[model samples]
Target: MTDEEVTEQVREDAEEQAEDAEAETETEDHLGPTSTKLVAEVATQDANLATELEGHLAQLEADREEARERADELESKLKRKQADFQNYKKRAKKRQEQMKDRATEDLVENLLDVRDNLVRAVEDDHENVESLKEGVEMTLKELDRVFEGENVEAIDPDPGTETDPQRHEVMMQVESDQPEGTVADVYQPGYEMGEKVLRAAQVTVSDGE
Candidate 1:
């Protein structure tokens, strides 16, 4: 080949090499560095997601533990409350029984005094009937005072009063000048405290006049 031909071929080969170098630089810029940065970003995002997930799991566990502790505390309180209620019930029952026993003892003690007075009156050797009557009357007066102090009332209705079934017991029907169904006579007086009737008054209800 001539010199001109060799020089022209060499120039064409140099231009082709330059174009290949530019294409290689563009491919490296688009694929190598950009791809490496995208991969690093994906790895960082994955790590962050893992960290957030661990935090959520830990919080859930802590919440579960707190709930269990609260439940235990409430259970303990419930047990204590139940025990207190049972103890209160027992105390109230015992107190009620004690009050009843005390009331019965007081009543018996008062009745014993009356019994002693009667025994003394009976055992006295005074042969005079008037003296015996006076002793008995005085004893009765003392008993009446005791009854009054103890809030005991005598049920001694008048003979002309209307017979009350609630406070009076009719022994027998009797003919009298009073109205029918009226108290003709009181056989025995009753004693009562408050609204309680110890015994009803014994009376004879009058028939028609």
Candidate 2:
């Protein structure tokens, strides 16, 4: 209402405003640098974490690719080995068949000469019976020679010798002076080549007298 009173009121209000402004300025000065520093530190940490995550992802992708490549390589090697083994088996079988055929051919070729000599002996005319017998004996000798060259042996077991079931066939047991379970006499001669018996010799085993 009075001019002095109004001026005093205005001065008091001005002093309170000045004090509030000073307090606000001090608060801003204290918090500004601290807030800005915190924001910068948080941004730096986020950038570092993002970079580490990217590196981990890249490494995982690389490892996965490497494992896939290794598996593929192993599969390829296995397939190749299987193919090679199959080829080897086929080749070995073919070689065995060829060897067997060649051996048979060689045997047939050797036998042809023996057959020709026998045919000639049969066809030739002889004046005397002795001459015919001689010719036949000569042919038999030639056949024996062929057998010797081919490594074919006669299985004519001697009397009183042991009877072998593998090379000898017992026709009948006959009473003889020879020991029992022994060969009495060879009825028919057999043939053998190397360790293999082509035909078993037919013989009569001795029965104890």
Candidate 3:
């Protein structure tokens, strides 16, 4: 075939192809407005799904932040509890130590008055008999000063005061006109230091009843 004839045939084929494509497009358009609206609706639904997914992600992030804050609060409370327990233990230990020291001091205080009596007895003796007594008296006085410095008081019960079982011990009850339940005489003095009572006085109670 001639070149011009071949060229013309190719052109005709291309025109028919274009016409077929246009016909197919026209068929889709003829399906009506429902087809166009459906496609637009599908796009709108996709947008809505994207928005809902983003909202869920935001909610999950908020929940995670709240959980973290709660964990911090719990951790703070635990630390405070530990500190308070430590402080309480320290206070208890200090109180126990103070009680033990008080007990030891009471023992020392009770013996001070006895030592003083022995010193006075020997101090009134002659020089040859006084050397040993003088040495003992000095030692006893020094021991008493040590007790006084530690706030240990030697309690000597007076006869006029009403007898209390906590502070006085009755050795013998004798008939008298003093009172029915009062201490008649203090045989041995009691000792008290601060708020603690070391020993009760050995006393004779009046049997006025």
User: lDDT: which is higher, 1 or 2?
Assistant: 2
- Model 3: ten consecutive residues of lowest lDDT: 121-130
With candidate 2 superimposed using the best TM-score fit, by how many Å does residue 184's alpha carbon deviate from the native? 0.8
lDDT of 2 by residue, 66-145 (tens): 99999999999999999999999999999999999998888778778768877877898888889888878877887788
Residue-wise lDDT of candidate 3 within 1-209, one digit each (tens)? Answer: 99999999999999999999999999878876888889999999999999999999999999999999999999999999999999999999999999998877776677766677666766655667577666677767876776676676776666656888887888998877778778788889887777778988889988886
Better of 1 and 2 by TM-score: 2
Candidate 1 residues lying further than 4 Å off, grouped into runs, are: 1-68
Top model number, TM-score: 2
| Candidate 1 positional error at 57, Å | 7.7
Clashing residue pairs, backbone N/CA/C < 3 A, model 2: none
Query: Model 1 over residues 3-94: C-alpha lDDT tens digits?
Result: 99999999999999999999999998889988899999999999999999999999999999999999999999999999999999999999
| RMSD of each candidate relative to the true structure | 7.5, 6.8, 12.8
Computed on alpha carbons, the lDDT of every model, listed in order, comes to 0.91, 0.93, 0.83
With a 3 Å backbone cut-off (N, CA, C), the pairs that clash in candidate 3 are: none
**Order of candidates by lDDT, top first?**
2, 1, 3
